[model samples]
Target: MGYINIDFTAGCTNNKWENLLHTHSIIQLVNTPTRITSTSSTIIDHVYTNHPENIVETVVPKIAFSDRYAKCITRKINQKDMPCLCHKQIRYRCFKNFDENNFLGDLNKTSFTQIEQIIDVQSATAMWYQLFLSVINNHAPIKMKRIKHVRQPDWLTDEVKEAQKKEKCLPKQRELE
Candidate 1:
């Protein structure tokens, strides 16, 4: 079995727990700066590894969704070829640049007289539908747009950002007893 790592969200300032873990040959790999809180500096989260050599680096990113800073683990692994795929989506025209009067005028200019002249009912219905579609497509054309996905919480607001900034500014503190 490989080494396992755990993160404790609750503020843990005591070094005694680490000593106990080390006594059992468990090594803690969270080597970043001191954990910051709104009130004080503490190491709430921890990363433990049985095979320390496998861990290349550990970092606590500034951006996070909660009070606990995100812990990132870097390890050496064999590289393999990966396929690059493009993800595209259709973006329909919005009313922002659409002029109602111009759209109505365009619709008025559409000729549907040929639909009534068709002898077959199916042909007339198809012609009428095609005319309607052509008018709409000319007015509100759909466009292909590519989107990049970002890892961010939907509920993250400006207030939460401010708080994260404040916590990040907290000074590095000495190991707690």
Candidate 2:
């Protein structure tokens, strides 16, 4: 992709830059004017791609920073080529049957004398860690499960979804008020 700041609509004059891009088999995708003002509109920002066939759609979103709009391109993707499309295996501890009183009783019954007897600080820490880990594992065992991964657009986050829900409810809220 190539973006150059040149007026592409200058009275139908032969554009050397465009001609150069054509020579290299590159095609300009954006036809709409990128920069617009009250007096005039011009295609100052350009988007060029060599593999135009792979591009599914080209959009010039109406989000203005200055006078220029943001350019977006959607490309065709193969599902088999994406590893993220497959179900992923993950291990997690299940705490559904965990009892706080039972866990506490087991912890209290556990002997820490072996750990205390160890003169080395590292070995004592390791033994202490292992003792706690064993008790925790017995109470809440680790299980593996496969989960399907779903992909969402980068701009559509949890916060954005919440905001959208609130926006949808505004009309009803106003009517009640």
Candidate 3:
């Protein structure tokens, strides 16, 4: 056969595209794949068109939302020993915001993280959509409460002391056995 050209999205001079309603409906909030609890194959129903099939599989780009994009997922894996293959089986049908390739610098914002089923956070793309990812041991939760110090008044100093004594007596009563 002779050389043939294809009008792929990448060929477009302006990087622009429209999100289809079908893709939007399948995903969960934020337009991510909602397959974990999906009773049907709606999540992975291969979308096919009459366009000529392109055997070539192009590489997809990555995007990060949070500033901690690089370290989004710190997965422990070893080649010698078989590591967890959970990430491999979890596939999401979220749409990419950037060009045909991938979005860059929107860490953990994909719909895949919002799935009801257990989704792996180790995938490279998952790191890019960190906003949807659940917090694990790797993340340090910010303390929600603050500590307060009680001040004593000169006139009520005796009352405060009496309360302390009563509290101490109650504890002693428990140990009195």
Best by TM-score: 2
What candidate 3 gets wrong by more than 4 Å, as runs, is 1-151
Per-residue lDDT tens digits for candidate 1, residues 36-149, read 667765445567778788788888787767655677889765445433345546354445566778888887898988777788775566567667757766667656566554
Number of clashing residue pairs in every model? 0, 0, 17
Q: On TM-score, who's better, 1 or 3?
A: 1
Local accuracy of candidate 2 as per-residue lDDT tens digits, 81-153: 7677568886667999999999999999999888868887855665686688789999999898787965556
lDDT of 3 at 163: 68
The worst-scoring run of ten residues by lDDT in candidate 3 lies at 27-36
**Least well predicted 10-residue stretch by lDDT in candidate 2:** 168-177
Q: On a 0 to 100 scale, what is the lDDT of residue 117 in model 2?
A: 82
Question: How well does model 3 score by local distance difference test?
Answer: 0.31
- Give TM per candidate: 0.34, 0.46, 0.14
